[model samples]
Target: MKPKVIGKCIIEKEEFPDGRIRIKRTTEGITAFELYWHLEQAQEEISKQLMGLLKPDIIKRR
Candidate 1:
């Protein structure tokens, strides 16, 4: 664990073979923050694409 996030960490997953992500709630477990970040980024991109029909804000923001 990084020194900065030693106490604040979690175990999360994304893009499973079953087409689902899973988050673990075990104690003293490893955390996949990288996966979480990518998943969130993907969701945002997808939302922007889906909302593009109603919103043109992303074009300017991006």
Candidate 2:
């Protein structure tokens, strides 16, 4: 299925024949963003990327 827009976010989900499910979530705005899942291993990366996009100046404060 195609991605669906909900509020300011776009969400999509797919299931593989092998029983693996993938999900993608992102926001619609000036800067494009995306998140992917392949049975874990990139959660931290996604979180960091989201924080950077949501608050670019946050890192400078630390």
Top-scoring candidate (TM-score): 1
How would you encode candidate 1's per-residue C-alpha lDDT over 1-62 as one tens digit per residue? Answer: 45222234556665688788777753443346755777899999999978876567757677
Error of 1 at 52 (Å): 1.0
Q: Could you tell me which 10 consecutive residues in candidate 2 have the lowest summed lDDT?
A: 30-39
State the lDDT of candidate 2 residue by residue for 1-62, as single tens digits.
54643347778998999999999988874321233333244877788888879795876688
Candidate 1 colliding pairs: none
Which stretches in model 2 have alpha-carbon errors above 4 Å?
A: 1-7, 31-62
Model 2 earns a TM-score of: 0.34
**33 in model 1: Cα distance from truth in Å?**
0.3
RMSD of each: 15.2, 16.3
Per-candidate TM-scores read 0.37, 0.34
lDDT (Cα, 0-100) at 10 in candidate 1:
57
Best by lDDT: 2
